[model samples]
Target: MGSTMIEKILARSSGSDSVSAGDIVFARPHRILSHDNSAAILGIFEKLGGKKVWASDRIFIALDHAVPPPDEKKAKNHTMIREFVARQGIRHFYEGGTGICHQVLPEYGHVKPGVVIFGSDSHTTTHGAFGAAGIPIGRTETASVWALGETWLKVPESFRIELSGEAPRGVVAKDIILYIIGKVSADGATYKAVEFHGAGVENMDISGRMTICNMAAEMGAKAGMVPFDKVTEEWLSGAGVKEYDPLYPDDDALYEKKMEIDLAGITPQVARPHKVDNVVPVSELEETVIDVALLGTCTNGRLEDLRQAVEILDGRRIKSGVRLLVYPASRKEMQQADKEGLIGKLLQSGAQIAVPACGPCLGAYGGVLAPGENCISTANRNFKGRMGCREDTGVYLASPATVAASALEGRIVSPYI
Candidate 1:
């Protein structure tokens, strides 16, 4: 058997050939997702004379991007999506405080093990945490899927990133992923499958695994995944998804390439301004003031991530110059945090709690940065001007621990300190 999570899932779903490590297979999609951004593209499909949706049950339309519409432009986008969803009679619609796409899709049980999922958003790969091979497709491809349940794919070469040792203090799966991106460069894993294993990975939870796999696109990977284990078993058990077994790569599983990461030496690092590739150790950056420190994305919005931030800033207040924002990944997570007093602790620490939504991750919603301002975020990308400002605006990507520490200090900070 191949060493690729993608290949294994595809082989089972297709039930035709015994897929090898690097063999490309034509796949039938089990689920397809779209939000406001991609829904607008589907509207164009209407103009192109597409009749009925290929399979309405298979398409999921979410209103995460502009829900509670941040501005007139965003509001218009939401309006377009509402009309489209209603017109298409797409029943699997998530709206009104539904939260981010990645968070909602899995919670709603749209992703099943051994199935192939594709979303219009780049972070669609996040679903791989559930043992599904999910990838992001362009609007054109989304439209095609809307007309036809199948899409073409190239079998990507497989790369194995095996983790060794344990993640050090104040270091998180996010930092580990940033470390990987630093080593591989931003485009190093382009169009490749990444399977993570080792003792370090085994210790991580589903949320942490989701954070790592969600950023696979940042490294230009086709998809990233960790084979389901006890953590996954626990998550699925809660949802009553029984009779499911996770597939692991064989010991001699074929891999096109392999790299081992030592998690013990890792410290808090940040992707500095301009590019996610322009990474530096948090200690290497000078005292740079920040305008915003936002946490809570599909990347780090899970309950444990909030607990870490709460531990770091439980009694301390954020610096006056910095605006610290927190948004839980879902209403369910928010309720749990509130019950556990995490929300109160955050507010007492000078963090502004926003409704369950995407917030500023897309750069179009609440808490965007202005010119000359800097932001420390737990969101996925930090490309120049990615969050609202022109390409010259600065953004830094870091772990929730680092982001929380920096918000208190009003500058970039190494959480280890």
Candidate 2:
């Protein structure tokens, strides 16, 4: 009979005493997020007859996709965005190389518990790691949020997923989520708020939680969150975030569905080409050869993820048939890796290091696959032509450790050793 955290957050943002699944309410978001797509959104904003944004301070613009401007068109887009930012006096614009929008937004203390945010990118659900509801909206919707500061949302049915038990060694947040998606299927939780609960999620680091939440969209979740806890507090404190009202679900909160997963049963998992939900255990794909290993993205591109990959490589070089591309999610993560000597080791191991941009995660450039080449990547999606413009190429999704291990062997392999 109690409200779920998503319900509560929705109620608070909408200034409503109470809300339930299916209730449409106009909610004012604490922040608005857009990346390179801001170019398109700003155009829509102008088309909507907007002169200035609702609040310059609340808007976050980060140039990530096609960053460093892959072409003259994109370069002009960046130039236009810069001029628009100056004209609108938007205060939170992040230039190219700062990092992915999701990574840098929280680094700047923008994401907080109980706040509501809407980003133009699907991975906006990533912010739910901090116990805030981060929803993805379309470009037109993003433009509307920029102009109106608020948008209407239908409260989604909530599901409670309790994760317990310790995972096997080499198993990580990415593999676990992949396992869940494989079990639940792609559209399993469509338009539903998913709350990650129990010991497993609670024990995970903020980076791990971000990885889990970042992929929630793959399962069609409207929001994916873990309640705020000490881990959350510590990370935010490091980011200089002092005050936030952490919201928790009522003990008897009603859920549309409830399930429990034992992490002990999980293993390094992979999603084969063409779809995120087409997953299987890595053991099943031992002989699968790989031509590339991509080890970074918003999903698994953090200092912890980089460290995981480096730990697997361990003073070894990747095999001949494999070209390894390691992209830091942000400059902060890259700097931390550099400070810890992770970068030097990777270079010595022959892994190619790229900037903190999205980097072919959506095939925006920096690293793209050729026909007949297959890549094992830490990125979230592996849709056809996702990592390359050529549909003849293929992509396989895995954790950082798995990607690195596969790179070392020139084949799809688990991180068991």
Candidate 3:
């Protein structure tokens, strides 16, 4: 009879005492998130016959995803988004070089615990690390929320994934998650609110938790959440969040499914071309050649990831003829790295530090691969054409340490090796 975290949050937003799986509720979100695609969303808002947003203060826009106007087209789109923000009186707008919207939003305290957040990007689930419900919606749904202030949500069944044991040397949150996704396959938790639990999850810093929840969408999960605890509290407090309502599932809450993963057995994992679940241990593919090694994304571009990569590089330049691209997730992260001299270290290691945005992750701009080339990256997905936009080009998903180690070796090598 107890409620899951999603159920409780939805019920509160719906002004109800309780909600169950399969129940439909109209919930008002604490934040409405959109990125560079806001231009399309703005057009939809106008088609809905909207002049002004229902709640300008609740709307947050960012010019990420194709930042720096890769072309005249993207530049024009950015122009429209800026004009739209000014016209609508939206308060939280971040321009290019400001970092990805997810990182910028949290850096500025836009995410608060126990609140519902709906975004136009699938990785909206990243906010769940802070104890919020982050659900991805389409562009039209975004415009509707802008005009109407509320939207419908079908309460999802819950899945509890329990993690145990400490990760071994050179293994990290990314490898652990890759191993889980490989075990469960792509459609494992479709439409379910996946809650992460146990010591393995609790041991991670806020950055690692964000990476876990950000990639939940890869598993077809509606949302992925880590329980709010001291880690969450400390991070939020540092981010200037003074008050929040953190929600936790009841001890006896019912779940549709459960899974357990022991991190001790996990190692550097790689999700091969065309599928994030097409994973195998790095040891299995030591000779896999790579043309590029990417070291950042919203999924793993935080300071922790950058530090780990720098540690592996350890004053060693990457292999000749291989390109190493290092992208920090946000301006804040970029600045911190500069202060700590990590940026200099990476640059000396033959890494090219790009702007703080979704660079090369979506194949929009930055370092796109040539035909028949392969890249080993610290990104979330490895779907076909995800990075290079060509069937012949391939991408391998791995942790920062693995990517760095492979960059030095010019092949898919384990960091531990």
Clashes of each: 0, 0, 0
- TM-scores for the candidates: 0.95, 0.99, 0.99
Greater lDDT among 1 and 3 belongs to 3
Preferred candidate (TM-score higher): 1 or 3: 3
Q: What is the lDDT of candidate 2?
A: 0.92
Model 2: colliding residue pairs: none
Greater-lDDT candidate between 2 and 3 = 2
Alpha carbon lDDT at 121, candidate 2:
92
lDDT string for model 3 (57-172, tens) is 99999878987887899899999999988888899999999999889888889998888999999999999899898999999999999999999999999999999988898788
Per-residue error for 263 in candidate 2, Å, reads: 0.4
What lDDT tens digits, residue by residue, belong to model 1 across residues 1-417? 444677777776566455765565667777888887755677767877788888778888777766687678877777777777788887788885877888888777777767788888899889888777888898987888788677777777778899999877778988999888999999999988888888988998888889989988888987888888788778877766776556666677778889999999888889887778777889888888888998998888888889989888868999997899898898888888999999999999988898787878877767878888888999888876678877447788999989998899888888766
User: What pairs collide in candidate 1?
Assistant: none
Query: Can you tell me which runs of candidate 1 are displaced by over 4 Å?
Result: 1-3, 20-24, 243-245
Error of 1 at 4 (Å): 2.8
Question: Model 3, residue 394: what's the lDDT?
Answer: 89
Q: What local lDDT does model 2 show for residue 88?
A: 98
* Candidate 2 ranges with C-alpha deviation above 4 Å: none
Off by over 4 Å in 3: none
